[model samples]
Structures are given as structure tokens and as C-alpha cells.
Target: MKVMNCPLNGPRNISEFAWGGEVKPMPDPAGVGDKEWAAWLFLEANEAGVVREWWCHVPTSYWFIAERNNITDEIIKTYPATEVFNTRVEFAAKAGAGEKK
Candidate 1:
């Protein structure tokens, strides 16, 4: 069983959660052609490596963001489930490693 460390609530049970969609710019619901709209609806980005995502707390009815390495199921970070995801990006930029973003 893998453990995920959350920002607000640390070390949550993975089973008590649900996987949401990709944390990215979704397609514009308006101002698009038929083909573009269909593509957006069907196609999605499954980015490798450090992929940011949303998750729902099934047991608690809470939502949050998770920074996880998809291939390994290694959760790197977590944040409160919010519409504006700028907080997650800001935190990542500050927590620097060998290189900077």
C-alpha cells in the first residue's frame, strides 16, 4: 500500500480516494469547430513523469491536487482541491532541487 502526503492532511489512505482528470488547460467549451470539440472531448493528455492531478476524498468528500510520478505511483506533493491551481505551481517553483524551473 502506497502512502500519499498531503499539504493540509498528511499521509492519506489511497483507497479512500478517487482519481480525477489531468491538471491542465481544458478545451474551450466555446469558440471551436465540431472536429476540435470532439477531439477535446475524446482526447486527453496522459503526461509521463511528474504529472499533476486532482483527487477526491471518497470517504471524506474532500477534493485535492496530487503531484505524482504516474509510472511509479510516487506522490510528490498534494494541495487543497481548488479551481485556481496557481498555488501548486508556486510551491513547486520555490521548492527547488538541483535545477530551477
Candidate 2:
């Protein structure tokens, strides 16, 4: 059976986890253009060899990072997302969404 080590929950079955996506720089939600935002959300580098990706432990709802070899499908390492993302991203509230016209 395949297994993956979750940063918070220790070793677990691979089926208990979910592959979120390839880790990439997120564009500014307010400042970025629509096309650019769409590209960032939909497109991926899809490169071969080792790549960093976001993964989630389904049972615990814990998110983390994983370095894996896409070509051979081997997980090189796994760690908490906090190791890389040190800051929390706060989004500004939309203008006049709740106010009466």
C-alpha cells in the first residue's frame, strides 16, 4: 500500500491525502488583471523532475508542502506549509457589495 507522511498527523495511507496543486507565486488579487488572474488560477508549469507542490491531509484538514519527482512519482520530502509561507494573505472587502444602493 502507498503511504505519505503528513507533517501534522505523521505517516498515513496515501488515500487519506489530496494533491492540491503545484506551488506557485500567487498574484495580487486586487491589483492583478482578470486575464493574469485567470492564468495564474488555471495554468501550471507542468515541468518534469522534482517539483514542490501543495498537499492536504484530508482527515485532519491540514495543508502542507511536498517535494516530489513528477517523472518517477516519488516523494522526496514533506513539511508544513509554514516553512515556506511565513505571512498570511489578507484580502480587502469588495466595494459596496453589502451597502444599499
Candidate 3:
């Protein structure tokens, strides 16, 4: 059984958590067309690499972000949702610089 570190609950069984899907930057909902909104809502990149995702602790109903490598199934870190904006910004900056974190 895999164990995941929950930001609020420390380490716990992976079964106690729910996969909340990938974390992507939100586009301005007001400016996007229906097609764009639909794509955003339904489509997933499913990239084969390190990706940041949202995970919810089912028992406590706490949601947090986890940076994991899809290929290896290794979780690098878990953090609160409040830190997501900064994490996304940092990830974007690294990508823009042609660097991987």
C-alpha cells in the first residue's frame, strides 16, 4: 500500500485520499468562449512527467497540492492549497527558463 503525506494530517494511507486531478492555471472565465471553457473543464493534459496535482484527504475533507512524477509514481512534496498560486507561478517561470524542477 502506498502512503501519502497530507499537509494537514501528516502521513497516511493513500486510500484515505482522493485524486482531485491536475492543477492547472485557471483562465479568465469571463473572457473564455464556451468551447474554451468546456475544454478546460473536461480536457486533461495527462503529461508523462512531473506534475502538480490536487489531492483531498477524504476523512478530514482537506484539500492540498502534491507534486509527483507520474512515470515513477513518486511524490516530491505536498502543500496547502493556499500555496498553489505561488507554486504555479514558480513552475511557469522555470518552464519559461527552460529548466525543470
Candidate 4:
């Protein structure tokens, strides 16, 4: 079973989460007009390889997390939903990886 840790909600089953698609190019609300906003909200780029994504924690109503390179079943950098602003992605420090909880 795959597991993920939401910064806001803490560790939880990955199945409980929902993929909101690649998290990139957050449209500028002040700069872009309504038309652009509409597209940004409704449309998705859907790029491949090393992409940042927004994952929703349904069971826990926490901030969305921005994961990187989310292809296949496993996604990297499952961080707090609020820490989305962190430009640098720190891969999960799992056991054997010298990461102590």
C-alpha cells in the first residue's frame, strides 16, 4: 500500500487523496483577466515527468499539497498543503534514508 504525508493533515493513506493535476503556472489574479482566470481554473496543462501537483486530502480537510513528479503510483515530495510556496522540493526522508521521525 502506498502512503503519503500531508503537511497539514500529517501522514495518511494515499488512496484517501485526490490528484488535482500538475501544480504549476498559478495564474496571476491581478495580472490576468477573467478570461485567463477561467482558463487557468478550468483547463490543465497535463505535462509529463517532474511536475508539481496539487493533491487534496478528502478525509482531512487540509491545505492542498504540491507534489513533484507525480506520474505512476508513487509521487515525490508529499509536503504540507500550506508549504506549497517552497520552491525547493525535499524528498521524504523515509527510514533507511537516515530520516528519523
lDDT for each candidate structure: 0.71, 0.93, 0.87, 0.69
Q: Candidate 1 clashing pairs?
A: none
lDDT of 2 by residue, 65-100 (tens): 999999989999999999999999998888898899
For all predicted structures, in order, the TM-scores are 0.65, 0.91, 0.81, 0.63
Query: In model 2, what is the error at residue 73, expressed in angstroms?
Result: 0.5
Better of 1 and 3 by lDDT: 3
lDDT of 3 by residue, 1-101 (tens): 89999989999999999998999877775567789988888888999999999899999999999999999999999999897565333222323576556
Ranking the candidates on lDDT from highest down gives 2, 3, 1, 4
Residue 10 C-alpha lDDT in model 3: 96
Worst 10-residue lDDT window for candidate 4 reads: 86-95
TM-score, structure 3 vs. true: 0.81
Q: What is the lDDT of candidate 1?
A: 0.71
- Please tell me which predicted candidate would have the highest lDDT against the true structure: 2
Question: Whose TM-score is higher: candidate 1's or candidate 4's?
Answer: 1
List candidate 2 stretches off by more than 4 Å.
Answer: none
Stretches of candidate 3 exceeding 4 Å from the true structure:
86-101
**Once all C-alphas are superposed, what RMSD does model 4 give against the true structure?**
15.3
Each candidate's number of clashing pairs is: 0, 0, 0, 2
lDDT of 3: 0.87
Q: Which of candidates 1 and 3 is the stronger one according to TM-score?
A: 3
lDDT pick, better of 3 and 4: 3
lDDT of 4 by residue, 1-101 (tens): 77787777677887888877666666654467789878888887767666667788888656575656646645677676455575644444435775565
